[model samples]
Target: MDNASSQINISFNFISDISNIDYKKKKDFSNVYNIQGMLNIRIENELFFSEEIALLEFYIQVKKWLSNKFDGSFYYNTIEVEGDDNPLIKFVASDNNYFISSPWGQDKVIAKAKAESLIESIKIFTEDFEEELYRTYKLNPKWYI
Candidate 1:
């Protein structure tokens, strides 16, 4: 693979009404948990996947993946977030490369790129996302990354 040609892009289009969240009540934080959004992933300038997902939950998963040093596979189910069972989207790492695929039947790699590139992309995305959360929603939730 040509490292120079590999790239990863992540962007979210939130569909939930965050203004109604009552920050005073801890239980109301569920509003954040239930926040829905469209997660768009692009690799090598091609769309890999675009799906509706739980925004906060998905952010937490990505943070966990970063904290784990990309040591193993990271999985997230889009349908599961909707309270239904579904196939999982997997990110697997090997020899410093990350392969993303939805392994419902076969090991079909959707996109593959270097770990450093993915990490850098995620870091940039996280920083901008955190800022947006703060500026737009006054949320500076505890981040694990």
Candidate 2:
């Protein structure tokens, strides 16, 4: 590992509650579902950057990677800006009830590597989200690897 390298660890969560269901005939209060996780990545032989700037770069690469991998428009929910440094990246998939984090590293290549790791992690699931994407979008399954 290079001394100049940097690492970013991002943890995120997505939650949905059925509180909108006003049940007139039942006593049940509400139903909820939460999907959350964490990711840690390190970029070697690259320059070190602040956590905030690195996160922004990671997210930009994520959007690019997804667009290249799958066709059609994929939009993120939040790109919050704070303290006038740079815009922060946050992705929320309300339709699929997904909460995901952008990858971070010293450079674009490092950030991309982290994003690829995330895709590989998805392939390990029994109900693989990446597989579903392949089927739905008619994409090559090997791309995730």
**Could you tell me which residue pairs clash in candidate 1?**
none
Task: Note the Cα lDDT for every prediction shown.
Answer: 0.67, 0.31
- Tell me the deviation in Å of residue 59 in model 1: 0.7
Best lDDT among the predictions, by candidate number: 1
Model 1 ranges off by over 4 Å: 1-5, 26-29, 77-87, 103-109, 143-145
RMSD of each: 3.9, 12.9
The most accurate candidate by TM-score is: 1
Task: Please give the lDDT score at residue 29 for candidate 2.
Answer: 17
For model 2, residues 1-145, the per-residue Cα lDDT tens digits are 3222123333322122234323352223121111112223323423322342222223334545464752322333223334432323333333222233333323523132233343443223213433433343333323322
Q: In model 1, state the lDDT of residue 64.
A: 73
Residue 125 displacement in candidate 1 (angstroms): 1.8
